[model samples]
Target: MSFSVEEGEFFGILGPNGAGKTTTLEIIEGLRQADAGTVEVLGMSPWPRNPKLLPRIGVQLQASSFFERLTAREQIRTFASLYGIPAKKADDMLTVVGMEDKAGTPAEKLSGGQAQRLSIACALVHDPDVLFLDEPSASLDPQARRNLWDLLRSLNEAGRTVVLTTHHLDEAEALCDRVAIMDHGKILELGPPATLVRGLDSATHISLATGTLSLPAAREVAGPDASVTDDGVTVTIATRAPAPVLTALADRNLLTGIQVRGATLEDVFLHLTGREYRA
Candidate 1:
């Protein structure tokens, strides 16, 4: 519940449904008041809805609501105008989010991914010092998600602080300089993704195409301690001692399509939060 983000750092907050991720973001963004704690952004209080703070931070919520009957271009221009930004700056933001081609298209007619891009463009139109994104890629397709990732990276590299809340562990791992993993409205872990993952006493997973090696053969090479599973399409072996298993597989010429994966942020998340569905 108590943590600090360094200036210009890409910090991520991760949690399942009802875990207070959005509530935390709202409080930090001056949209909601905290019950009993001090909060500061840019060395100023946010709870009173400081007008000065509004111009320094940009927020893109999970559900974006654009002005009625506005095109992509007009929507962002309106947002820019509110901050006293010029129309040319708004147009540049559209291009920044790759929405220039859809600029003239009505917001209602844009696809979900395109709409997300527009929302991001609107948030960035003012060129705020900090940006807040709540599940920005929640419903985006793979390509759109990757594209958004690139855009976010570029923004951070340009010296803008980004505070993101997402359920996608991979996105956090790939984008954040540090992350906070929360559950039951409390932060359970906080650290760099690699450091958190390395602290886990978890097994490495080795996988291959199903037909490449028989399950029985893989199990034999993997040994009794290692767990092996074949789910038709892929055969996976989980082992604490992967070196010996890999050496055995190499000796037997059974390494085709082999993929070795170390512990990842997802593993760290599941270990801290437990394996259960969240509403």
Candidate 2:
């Protein structure tokens, strides 16, 4: 739980439900207190609501609420007022989140994705240096999620430090510069996704179409410790060398449509935590 997030870096915390991911983030954001362990956010203690620090960080909780009857622009204006931000600043944020056209739409009328984006826009209206996003896209559709990702990338590219928690492995792989895998209130792994995946002893995977071959023959082709799925065609070889298997299949002219690919973050997570990234 003790780590530092550098400026302009997209850092991710990943874990399953009730794994303390949200608790850890809340503690860091000063929304909740930790019984033990010291936390310094942006070099300032989060407790006691440090006035200097509060204005420097923006937070988007998993779920945020506003006056249900207020329009998006009105909600933005209300939040901006809390930070003493100008009205024009709120308008700019609305434009930034693609809610400009829907500025007049009431909070209760917005689609789930639009509301989430508006919440993010409100958080960013004050022009904070750091952003905390907790499951920002958890309930969003695929297209909406992609849109949020692009917006986040733009924000990071403009030098905003973002700390994100998500269950989506692919999202983390695509957006995070580095990630810490947490479970049971402790870090199980921490590194760039590619480096962590490459560090696994099981580095190669061979997938074949199901019903395209025999399990016994495929297992014979693959050595012991190789895992063959019940479907009988997808075999994973946990070895540094995959060329030999490829060569063997080629020699026997049995390689047909076989694919060799590097391990993914999901593979590394499964190996380390014994849990699947279902989301």
Candidate 3:
């Protein structure tokens, strides 16, 4: 329920449904008011919706409604005008989000991914120092999702702070410098994805299909987080360094049909919440 993001970091909020992801984002965006406690963004309270702060922060919601008849360029220009910025700023932002080629396309004609990019363009048209996104890649195809990641990374590199909420663990792992995992309206874990995953012990899961051998507790080889699951003598162990465990098991001729895989953000999530990131 509590965490702080460093300026200019790609901070991600991750959680399942009913985990308060969108509610937290809405509070940060100044669109919703919290009944208790205090909230701040960019050095000012957000609940009151400060006009000065509005121009310094950009927000892209999970869903956006655009003027269907307006060309993407026009929509962005309208936002630019609202901020008293030059209309040319719209073109620049569209280019920044990789939507320049589709600038003239009607909003109704753009695909979901393209429209999401346009939404981001509109958000950035005012030259905000911070960008907020709620599930920017929610429905994007794999390639589109990757493209969005590149855009976000480039924006951060250009000195814009970004805060986003997403359900994609891989997205958080690949892009966020640090991530906060929430459940039941509480932040249960927060840290760099790599560190959290590595902290899960083996940082790798080894599954071996042994024909008829029984092995010592995985906890003995790895640690408490290490465990074994059996399917016809197949044992799975979660560990940080597999070499030592594998070598020790090999000494007993207990290794068979071994498979090794590295840990991931998904594993960390499951470890913390005992549930999948279905939400």
Candidate 4:
């Protein structure tokens, strides 16, 4: 329940639906009040909100609202004017988000991903020191999601602190420097992706394709503490050590098209949460 995000770090908050991810972010963003917990962001209490701190942080909510009839350029310019940001800087932000080509296009005419990028552009128009993204790539296609990931990486490289909420385990593994896994309003786990995934178990996975292989025979050959599953040709062996299994299979002339791999975050998540990360 208590945590801190260091400067220039890409921190991710991950959880399933109704896990209080959005609620926690809303509390930090000064949009919601916490009854008991003490919250500090950049050395300021986000609840009794500081006027100066508000302008120095950029926030992209899960959903946004804008004048549908306004062009992307006009929308940015309007936000800039409200914040007293220069017009040229607004255009530059639009260009940074790859929306310059669509600047003349109305918000209603923009695609979901494009509109999301424009929302992010507006959030960054004032050059804030901290950025919050709430499921920024939720509706985006794979390539568009990658583009947004690259943009966020560039922001982090430029020394901006980013706090993001995501349900995509792979995206968290790829983009986060450190991740906090939350559930039921509490932090269940926190650490770098690699460290967390490696903490699950000291085992390697070996997969093989042999066309309707025998699961029981494979398990017997894999020895104790190892498991084998066969699904009509595709076989997967989970073992604490792969060398012994490989040797046994080789000795039996059963090791063909074998591949050894390490555990990933998805595997760890499934092990801990008892559910697949579908979002």
Best by lDDT: 1
Q: lDDT tens digits, residues 171-250, model 2?
A: 99999999999887889999999999878876577777765556777777776756656445455444456777677678
Looking at model 4, residue 250 earns an lDDT score of 84
Indicate the residue-level lDDT of 96 in model 3: 76
TM, every model = 0.96, 0.87, 0.81, 0.90
Each prediction's Cα RMSD? 1.4, 2.8, 4.3, 2.5
Candidate numbers, best lDDT first, in rank order:
1, 4, 2, 3
TM-score of 4: 0.90
Q: Number of the top candidate by TM-score?
A: 1
Clashing pairs in 4: 212-233
Better of 2 and 4 by lDDT: 4
- What digit string (tens of lDDT, one per residue) describes model 4 on residues 1-279? 988899999999988788888999999998899989788888888887679788889999989888869999999999999789999999999988888899999999889989899999998999889999999888788988888889999999999999999978889999999999887788888999999987987578788885535777777877889888776767888889788888887887766667888888777666756684534
Question: What local lDDT score does residue 201 receive in model 2, on the 0 to 100 scale?
Answer: 71
- Candidate 3 structure quality by residue, lDDT tens digits, 1-279: 677878889999988878899999998889999878888787898878788799899999989999869999999999899999898777888877778899899999998888988888888888789999999986688887888889889889998899999888889999999999998889988899988887875357787675434555554665565566676666777676678888877886767667888978888888777755453
**TM-score winner between candidates 1 and 3:** 1
By TM-score, the better pick of 3 and 4 is: 4
Q: lDDT, candidate 4, residue 150?
A: 92
Steric collisions counted per model: 0, 0, 4, 1
lDDT value, residue 120 of candidate 3: 80
Better of 1 and 4 by lDDT: 1
Clashing pairs in 1: none
